[model samples]
Target: MSRPLVIDEAEVEITAIRAQGAGGQNVNKVASAIHLRFNIAASSLPDDVKARLLASRDSRITQGGVLVLKAQRHRTQELNRLDALARLHELVQGVAQPPRARKATRPTRGSQLRRLAGKSRRAVVKAGRGRPDLS
Candidate 1:
């Protein structure tokens, strides 16, 4: 098993912004949403992890190598901040371990024969669905 990745809190940039949607009167007055930006190129993560993160297909990752996350699910700034941090941690953990290399193997003779038998049986069943022969 690979070791867990630890991201420095200081490395993450968090900003408070007003969430969009119907939030009554408090929505206009308070900034409860959190905007997070993490620069993969500047982070202290491992080389492979950094490479994987940069190469990820997530649209949030920009050409400048910065990952942008918006957390507005919660009603409070603190909750949104935590949500953003959790998401960042999840993303990092996902690519922390390298995928296992696959070994190639061929089908056994018995299995091949069984597959052929199943195919022939299916063919017979399908053929039976054709028009009946009228004498």
Candidate 2:
């Protein structure tokens, strides 16, 4: 099992926004949604972790280097806020784990021979598909 991640609550900014879409009168009247924003460039994260987080292709991360997460699934404002912060913690933890470096390797002699043999077989099959010479 993975360890529980502890994110500094001070790093994230949470704002209450009206939930979008069809909620009838309740949507406009109640501010039961949350908008969580974390500035990647200005965070107190390690340099390598910050770089990795910024390089991530997550849709939540905007072009301005801000991680924006909307939490409107829950009915309560506090729940939504917690949900957004949890998501942010998950995102940070994802980048916190460093990836293993890929070792450079060359194809084995048997694999190379098999590839060349497959190519030769394909060429022969294509050559056979052409019209045969009579003369």
Candidate 3:
């Protein structure tokens, strides 16, 4: 049996920064943006999950195997913090479930026949593009 996945809140580091872009005068004064950082190498997650997370091609994962997420959609700092945590949960949950193995398949006999017939028709059309037959 595999071990259950669990992420401790203490392992996550959260910081509040200023949000960028237009937002009247309040945007520059308040630190509403949330910056969440989770280190995969130092987390309690299973080894497999850690491996998969580091191997992921997501732009959020840094070169040092740390997951960095920035949340600024909400105007309040508390909401942005929650949003960042939610996103982190989603990423961890995704890695917890193993991917289904793919089953190789071949085209049915009827499909193969149809494909061959289409190829033959295309060849005939291309052959017709050549000079017309002379008597």
Candidate 4:
């Protein structure tokens, strides 16, 4: 059986705010934008995953170790809420999958020879660019 996805509900927080940009009269009145906040430090995720999530260069993650995602693309509150939650799930899942470690490698002898040959060819072409000695 496939394992269930584990997420700590306590680590996430959500709030509604007025979405900016064009929306007619309704935009000024209603707070439809969903703000989802996830605290990396307080999360129940593994240390490695937490480190990756916190170290990520995403603009959503603030300096205070909180990830803030805004979902205002959807018109309704329910859809916006779902979008925010899905984004959170995706972000967590991304960190959950660890990257494979890279093994050190060296260039092959043939590759080295090819590179040297290419450099020699380029040098000959450049050498030809010089004016012929008139003397």
Candidate 5:
């Protein structure tokens, strides 16, 4: 298997922001959450990888091809920062490998027969519900 893409530290911009939700007194004062921003267009990744990353349906990737990640699971700023970087690494790695091409195939003969049989049975049931024809 090919190795995953390694993002350069300089390409990522991390900011420590105040975390939301409950943490008692520490939550109100400490800036433990890390917000990571990486511009795919400006990064050193391969052209194909960049295209794949941008084309992904992930909400984290913005319209301008910038990835935004928030890490606040940890209480400490250092831990949050590391978490953000790890997440970013995974995101890049996700698009590193090309997707497998889907092979088109027709339905099996047995399945087709089963479908036709079901349709005919339904038609018979519907026909039974109709009014009796006068001679």
Candidate 6:
């Protein structure tokens, strides 16, 4: 998120294919869906970004480091292509920034004392319900 990275169209392989599912008769007749594939290894993205992307373990990514996406949400071919590109950008951006290192922390003294005090109050209530001195 620090810097927006641009993906060149040449790096992506987009193909038009028929969209599956319910649609007037046009679904079977028109190739309105788009199949997009981008090879992370061959992209111009930063080396660190590429490494993280490949290590992401996303099922959409093939063993060869290719990201495959299918966009058929839109009825138009152009819209579907744009949708696929947008999704690709989103994926690349997700892995662009490295994760921040975690810092070790400990509970404050006041919090520790407050927890013990609550436990003592509960114990007294439970003990009162147990027996009437059995006398």
TM-score of 2: 0.86
lDDT of candidate 4 over 1-135, digit per residue (tens): 324347777778989998889998888888889999889888887898889999889998999999999999978788998999998988888777778899999999999999999999999999999999999
Q: What do the candidate models score in CA lDDT, each in turn?
A: 0.95, 0.88, 0.92, 0.87, 0.94, 0.95
* Residue runs of model 5 more than 4 Å from their true location after superposition: 129-135
Tell me the spans in candidate 3 whose CA falls farther than 4 Å from its real position.
1-4, 133-135
lDDT of 6 by residue, 31-126 (tens): 999999999999999999999999998999999999999999999999999999999999999999998999999999999999999999999999
TM-score of 5: 0.91
Winner on lDDT between 2 and 6 is 6
Per-model TM-score versus the true fold: 0.82, 0.86, 0.90, 0.90, 0.91, 0.79
Q: Can you write out model 5's per-residue Cα lDDT over 1-135, one digit (the tens) per residue?
A: 698788999999999999999998898999999999999999999999999999989999888889999999999999999999998998888889999999999999999999999999999999999999998
For model 2, how does the per-residue alpha-carbon lDDT over 12-64 read when each residue is reduced to its tens digit? 88899999888889898999999988998988887888899999898988999
- Residue-wise C-alpha lDDT for candidate 1, range 1-135, written one tens digit per residue: 777899999999999999989898778889999999999999999999999898889999999999999999989999999999999999999999887899999999999999999999999999999999998
Candidate 4 global lDDT: 0.87
Using TM-score as the measure, name the better of candidate 3 and candidate 5.
Answer: 5
What C-alpha lDDT, on a 0 to 100 scale, does residue 95 get in candidate 3?
A: 80
Clashing pairs counted in every model: 0, 0, 0, 0, 0, 0
Query: What TM-score quantifies how close candidate 6 is to the native fold?
Result: 0.79
Model 1 whole-model lDDT (C-alpha atoms): 0.95
What overall lDDT, based on C-alpha atoms, would model 5 receive against the true structure? 0.94
> Please, what are the lDDT tens digits per residue for candidate 3 over residues 1-135?
345466799999999999999998899899999999999999998898899889889999999989999999999999999999998998888888878899999999999999999999999999999998897
Residue 22 displacement (Å), model 1: 3.0
